[model samples]
Target: MELMTFESPVNAVLSGQEAPERSLKRRVPMTARTKQLSDKEMDALERQIPDLAQIATKTAYARALLVSDSVLRVDSGDLVRISLDGSKTVVAKAEPRRKVKVGEVITVRRIEDQTAGGRA
Candidate 1:
């Protein structure tokens, strides 16, 4: 008895040989979820927070600034709070496992509603 092996068309091409004739799937380019901010908008945001101006020049950091809903300030013991619509919202609670310095910027998402008593 003899065993037969199969190789993908991609592997054949990588080995410097032509792939056997078969239907090929069309590839499409993926689009980014977040878009870069315009120069005017970037200037305005930089004016608000001069410190971010240096980071905003980079592609990744610039996109984050545009997409984030709110940025919070971290307090001692890893506490973070965000203010929206004239109300203060707690984004992160103090964690005994970690220590964060005061005045550090932190990004957080709501995993569960605090009003629900931490129930998912």
Candidate 2:
């Protein structure tokens, strides 16, 4: 019988292998991770989530502004465009909220950006 060059159980036995005892002895418990916070202890942090989100959005908008890319978000039932300098332009009346149906298709209309001379 011919033995395969790779992945043959018989060949695996012939190849050299590491001793499991030494490998287990080298592992040490990791201590750098932060301790888990209880739900009550985390309430204070959760309260600041909105502030963090706003800051993150501003940072992201600033970066997008560098590339001349517009940010689109729905606010107060309308589609709003956010510029890099933090100016908001109402684009249009946003689509009404609705329950997600099975196999629904969302169509995003892309138009030309006249000011930046780029494809929308």
Candidate 3:
């Protein structure tokens, strides 16, 4: 009696044996989802928004001036001279609108020089 052997694809690969050719096939399904907004819906959304141009710039609680001296000062209610880059701005100091101590940080509305405005 003679013994015969047959090799399976998976077993042949695992045992370092050559595998026979076999056709492979795969099945896939197509799927999709989409939404559309009606013209009425768009018009309703537009009506809910207020006109942006109606918005106004924020009012400042306190005013400030920056001078070339690298000094930031609050309006002291007295006229003060701010000198910047060879220019001067004289801003009438108003009573410190906000409690500000010496050496407090204050942003200036605009950059000016010593000649900007002053009694001098």
Candidate 4:
């Protein structure tokens, strides 16, 4: 004896057009719910994961005082050097998300890679 394969007689069945068996097992509709976290719980979760805070701080854009057209003072201790043209200053290699002004504050973020033993 040899095994043989059979095809559906109707094209609707072959093309999965709401067959009787499939229609019988209907899908259940899902309901959406919003969840809110308390400030203390959120703080506890942040403390549990120190890297989350580090990542947030690193990605967050901050206003830095432009010491000069080419230099920006992020804080009392940090200074960032940027490229300066006649009237334009470029901070990073990529296009900045926000516009910058000379002799004024600009939005910037510090990008750093945490590596082990100084090797990537």
Query: lDDT tens string, model 2, 11-106?
Result: 222332222212222333444557899998899899999998887666555545555656778989898887757788887789887787899997
- Can you give the TM-score per candidate against the true fold? 0.24, 0.46, 0.19, 0.20
| Clash total of candidate 3 | 18
Which of the predicted structures, 2 or 4, would earn the higher lDDT when compared with the native?
2
- The residue-by-residue lDDT of candidate 4 on 7-119, one tens digit each, is 33233243444334333333333554557989998898878688866654433312111212243323333333432343333333443346557788765554556322232
Candidate 3: tens digits of C-alpha lDDT, residues 1-120: 333335433333334433344323233333434558799998987876664223211111111112123223344455544443434344555554578789999886643564323322
Question: After best superposition, candidate 3 residue 112: deviation in angstroms?
Answer: 2.7
Q: Model 2 RMSD to the real structure? A: 17.1
Report clashes for each candidate as comma-separated counts.
0, 0, 18, 0
> How accurate locally, in lDDT, is each candidate?
0.49, 0.61, 0.41, 0.41
lDDT value, residue 106 of candidate 4: 66
Deviation of model 2 at 24, angstroms: 34
lDDT of 1 by residue, 1-120 (tens): 333334544434334334354334444335436778999998898788755545444433323323353334456655544332334456566766656689988787766555334422
Off by over 4 Å in 3: 1-34, 51-110, 114-120
Candidate number with the higher lDDT (1 or 3): 1
**What are the clashing pairs of model 4?**
none
Winner on lDDT between 1 and 2 is 2
